[model samples]
Target: MDTEFELFDDDKSDVNAPPSYHAVSMSSISADSVQCEPSFVFSKAQTKQIRTTVLSLIRGMVITPDFILSSVGPTLDACATSLPAAEFTDILQESNIEGHTPLYWAIVNKRPEVLSAFHKFITAYKNDSFHDVRLACMVTNDHTLFTKLSLTSARLHKMERTLNLSLGCADEIQVYEGDTENQFTAKMQITMFQTRIRVVQKLRMEFIAQGRIWGLLFHVGDDTRWEASIYLSKHSLPARPKALLTVEAQNEQHQVLKKEFKLKEGCFLAASEYTNFSIRTCTSTSASLGSWPIFNDTIYMDSNGTLHAKLDVALQ
Candidate 1:
């Protein structure tokens, strides 16, 4: 933070006198002047005029190009005023000077008012351009704008819909085989955690309703012994908890295939012929697998039955 005042030598001060009685003077003062500078004042009518001018210019930039040249000062002052909620999406979506949007000017000038107006406009329109507005808001660290946009029901719905649709389209799951030296390595990437969990739950329920066991291979280690589990019903499954896996070492590799299981009650029984192996040496071959009941990724089964991998199509 910078200050407006400057320090100067006070030549009139009596250095030897008591501190309370000491006098000080600066070089630039007029000795007879006893008044301070007049404060700035604007009449209500003037203030209204200024706001109208500024808002008009802003609106013009959005709906037309005639006001671009005269928008600078008025737009700034309007930002400094308390005005009615205004929509500037048109400006963001339409106004461009050689590829530069009005948002560019707003950020460059550090105009929170302009940015806020734009944010409100974007949220209302629920346009694809909201992404750009979001990025700009983040870059500017505009808390008010960010919060407003983030809390919009439309925006939230858009995000959820996108995640669900992507999950539905997921196609490939490849379990990378590692070397024997790195048998414990099980890399996991759960791109959309909540969505993926929901999909898995739906799949488990569908399998149980049909009296079929959901054959899932939980990779244990280099030991080639695995087991399969069967889910009995959806209501029996445990509520999915928040889960995150960002590293290979964090994966819990318990190679087992259970049968006749209830999700809520946990695995009921394990398959008699279980086989587990080191993920690194399982097999280089990648298989074309089916989509999970609710998610899009194709499920790939490794030759060694030790690892399972899914390619994230949601991100694409």
Candidate 2:
């Protein structure tokens, strides 16, 4: 935000005033007699080039405020998942040039993606071992964001907090029931301590049709795992709770890069249960738990698009 202007001394009058010019005939002033100091000035083209160079340099810096504000998704994703726990805490605690924490900056700019990524990122930090809870709590702009951050406080970092600190999506997966695509989602929660850590993730199945259900499990566990499962109700068939489902991994464009598989994967629920099928095992080798990318939004298709699911599989 620096301005390219010169400050005048006391000897000069009205430094802020616009320049005044007196109308004079061209012949009145002789070019040879009038002498003036030559100032270094760039031409229009040169000025534009200079501006472009400066902007490019600014963009190259890792912690520039402009870059952070514009691309919070990628920025926060990198910080949250890749950085060491201490370094991540340092960034959250540090303030930008405008005297605002990164979290506050994201809040002021309404970067929900950044906030969400941060929430996912801090899930890896050891519970009760937090050292920067104060910095996160100081943000008062967004009450919702503040509430989420408050849940990270050391004093409140307990089993209840563990349940509250879940990292998953609401209604992330959906299945069409008789032409209506009903929703399903899995929530992954992490609990950490000074000496021991425990993690629990669950996928809830609420709606079903013809005793068939399809869903994706993102980051089922470490190594960037993803799973696609199909389940059938025990009552749908005469005896066995098992069913057959074909699963395949599709790219963003829905192009199948991985082949399909037919497997015996299905669970049964009685009338007491809300949905009939709630199987957790993936039916394909491609979708099984392995080393997948963190930002992988790859879609896992069942029966070639009859049912689909995807999730942000970020590493803490």
Q: Which ten-residue region of model 1 has the weakest summed lDDT?
A: 203-212
Please give, for residues 1-316, the per-residue lDDT of candidate 1 as tens digits. 1112111123542353212211212111122221112213556674444343433344333323223434444443334333333423443554232233455445434665555555544534434344434434434434344344442222335454455466553222223333432221113333443243343321111111111111232221233222122211111211211111221212236333212212222222222322222211111111212222133332322322122332111100
Stretches of candidate 1 off by over 4 Å are: 1-89, 96-100, 107-117, 120-122, 125-128, 131-251, 254-316
For each predicted model, how many residue pairs clash, with residues at least 3 apart or on different chains?
39, 0
**RMSD in order of candidates:** 22.6, 21.9
Model 1 TM-score, 2 decimals: 0.26
On lDDT, the leading prediction is: 2
lDDT tens digits, residue span 1-316, model 2: 1112222222453543222111222122223211112212545564343333322221222223333445445434433333345555645544421343444434444455555555554544443223222232322212233334442232243543445345322222222222223222222221121012113232322222332222222225444354433332221221122222233344555553332324334522222223324443332222453333222242542322222322222111
**Candidate 1, residue 46: CA error in Å?**
17
Which ten contiguous residues of candidate 2 have the minimum total lDDT?
Answer: 189-198
Model 1 residue 127 distance off true place after TM-score fit, in angstroms: 3.3
Q: Candidates' lDDT values, in order?
A: 0.31, 0.32
Superposed on all Cα atoms, model 1 deviates from the true structure by an RMSD in Å of 22.6
Candidate with top TM-score is 1
